[model samples]
Target: MHIGLISETFWPDINGVSMTLAQWSQGLLDAGDQLDLITPHAHADTVGLEGIPWQDAKPFRHISASRVPLPGYRGVKLGLMLPKAAKRLWRKSPPDVLYIATEGLLGLDALRYGRQNGIPVVGGFHTNFQYYLHHYHLQWLTPLMRAYLRRFHNACTRTLTPTQAKKNQLLRQKYHRIHRVGRGVDLSQFYPRTTQERSLWRQQHGISDDTLLLGYTGRLAAEKNLSQWIESYQILKSQHPSPVKALIVGDGPWRDHVLSALPDALWLGELTGEALAIAYSAMDIFSFPSMTETYGNVVPEALASGTPVIAFDCAAAHELLQPGKNGDCIGVNEAEDYTARLIHLAHDYQQSPQRWRTASAKSIHHLGWPTVNASFRRHLVQAIHEVKRHGRQRSDFVATKS
Candidate 1:
């Protein structure tokens, strides 16, 4: 099968969407399927490309366009592609199915091209861009953004989201042909290490084995809802009998603010590969506070690393977490509950550390990259088959009525 992935973000961008795309591209290529990628140039985020294996994962054909840095974001950028270029590229070597990953101008242009050319276009709901407006003080434009997203996705043959909860939400909002396709974790890279190994790593970093190390790994952004989580951590630290410390990973526009908020934290900025896997293993607990995430890739990644997670009952947590067994999945906006859960988990860990180690290993072992990539491939094939069964005429593509 030949697949076309159109997105504003890709490899080296250091985000959930890009990471997932990279995984899918590599998996598909390994399976003997062809893939064409269209995204912003890696030079847009020069630093991000340093450790990323951009040379290893090669797609069939790659297309890049001009990009401008997004306001308030350091390395993030929005891609700009002309319609003529898109048409010309596809006319020469078109793909069997087109997957639109981002709701930016580049994705929209590719979507339009696919629709006009009778190609099967599948939209991916990866990020909650509409909800992000609240963090940027553009709440007034949220409704407009929401409507635009709905229309854009509805126009596609099928829309794929990472979690069942997100699929349900889109369905309630009248989104057509919504499907649930999950994200996966690389267990080989992110899995449990021995207690002695963890102890040695912690000791080297000046962290005691007895102290509870609460951590957050992802982009430090306003929409991530980091500040509230930091506050909850502070509250947990003060009230809990056990000693607690923080380990902050990743960097973004909110880096300075997070630094100021958690001055005593071990701030290791943007770790990858083995370094990133070790960081997750060192943490006693992983807390994800972002209510705006469509999937929250960190949840499974943390669980895979044998680090118990604490997250709001939304997104991936709504599906993956089993409260008290695997990790605490508190209700959204319940700040007190979030703090209380952290304290409770910390106490439980101190009493029986082995229990959490066992739970973490068993929690998300089913979410390997092979299973996710296969499911995604099936969806793309389904879309292609649908287009073929029905004619390519606009009237024949009644996805909205489906």
Candidate 2:
């Protein structure tokens, strides 16, 4: 099958959407399918993807759309509105299925073109854009955003959500044809390292053996609710006997703000590949307070790296994390409750680190990429078949009437 993916975010973006799409694309190609990616051009000096091998002799084709910096966002770009260009490309060589991964201008154009040409379109709900409006001080636009999202998704044959919880929320909002497809983690790349290797990693980073390292791996932005994580760390540091260290990975516009507030914390800007895996393994606990995530990719990755997590009882945490088993999932928006749990986990880990690490690793052992990719492929084929069946039914009815 020939599939076309349209998104504003793709390779070199270093976010959950890009990462998941990359894995899914590779999986489809490996399973004897062809793909055509349409995405925004990378920013100056940023790395972009090279050629990908396909079942056909021709290399994977990437159509680079023009991009401009997104308003009120740092290090983010919005693809130029290009309905004509998209229409031209699709009309020349139509795809068997079209998957829209974002609701940005680029994705909207592709959705419009595909619908007009009688092509089956599948949408993926990856981000909580409505929740983000409050963070950006555009709360007034919440209703508008929700209405637009509902209309956008209802037009697609099926809208794929990362969690059943998210699908339920969309159903409550009157979204149509919503499907649940969860994310997966790379077990080989994110598993636990040896005790000696972890000790050496800490030594290299100037962390003493006794220090309790609490880590946060994602974009440092206001919408992420990072200040709550900082407050929780402060509370844990005050109560715990062992020295406590905060390790922050990834960079965003709020990096300077976090740095000013917590000057002593270690900030490792955007570690990828093995470096990211090692960082996750070296941490004693992964602290996340964000409530706006559709699915927190870091949560499962942390668990796979043998590090327990402390996250709000929402989104992926609600789906994956079990209280008092692998990690603690506190009440949603309950700051005091979250902080207390953090302190308790810290103290408990100090007593039995090996047991907690083993439980953490065991929790997410089944979230391999192959299972996730297979599910995605099945859904794509199902949508295509449904659309074709409906089309045939409509044609037969018209012929009978004539």
Candidate 3:
């Protein structure tokens, strides 16, 4: 099938949406399908997408849409609508399916063109924009955001969510044709490191073998609920007798806040590829306090690296984590409970480190990128069939009316 994948976020943007969409694009191409990647032209120079196998061997096109800096977001841009450009692109060679990965201007334009031209469109619900409102002091926009999201997604043949919990939430809000396509971890790239390698990593950071290293990976932003993470870490260190150190693995607007609050914590900035995997492997415990994740990719990456995770009981944690097993999931918004869990986990680590590591690795062993990519392909096929069937029915109805 010829697929057009549209999103404001793509390569060079170090976020979940961009990474996942890039994987999906390669998956479609590997399956002997054509893909036209429609995204903003931001960070064009930094887009190191040549490493994707399909991009080197298959028929793939990129449509660069105009973009401007997104308001209130540091180093982030929003794609502008270009309906005329979209029409021209599709007029020459229309896609068999349109996958809208975001509800941004670019996605809306693609959705409109797909609808007008009778092309099947599948939307992806990747981010919790409604939850992000409170962080940005735009709580009043919650209702408006919800309404817009509902209308935008409902217009598509189906909307794909990254977690079952998120799909259920969308269903409760009256979202139609919702489907769950959870994210996956690249096992080859994010696996546990050798003991010597892990030791070297700790040594580089001036961390001793006895010290418990707590890690958090992802954007250090307000929407991530990072303040709570720092508070929990501080509480854990205070309560525990063991030497505790923290490693924050991403960069964002909240850098200053994190630095001021946790002065001794190692800020590794943004890391990718093997370096990121090594960081995950080096951690004894991964604490993710974010409450707004659609599906925390870092959670699985940590688990894949044999590192126990502590997270709020939502998103991927709600789905993948089992209390007292691979990791602990604190109740939603229960800050005290979250901190308590962190302390408890630290104690458990001191008791039996090997057992915790084994459990963590075993829990997420099934999450491979190949499996996730196949599931996504199936969803696209289903959306295409639904659209074709509906079109046929409409044609028959019109003939009967005539």
Q: What is the C-alpha lDDT of each candidate?
A: 0.83, 0.84, 0.83
TM-score of each: 0.93, 0.93, 0.93
Which parts of model 1 have CA positions greater than 4 angstroms off? 42-56, 82-86, 393-402
- How do the residues 45-149 of candidate 1 rate in per-residue lDDT, one tens digit apiece? 112233454335442666666689898887777887633554576688788999999888788777777887789999999989899999999999999999889
Query: Which residues of candidate 2, in runs, are more than 4 Å off?
Result: 42-48, 51-58, 83-86, 392-402
The CA lDDT at 369 in model 2 is: 87
Candidate 3 accuracy as lDDT: 0.83
Candidate that beats the other on lDDT, 2 or 3, i.e. the better one: 2
lDDT of 3 at 55: 33
Which consecutive 10 residues in model 1 have the weakest lDDT in total? 393-402
Question: What TM-score does structure 2 among the candidates reach?
Answer: 0.93
Worst-scoring 10-residue span by lDDT in model 3? 393-402
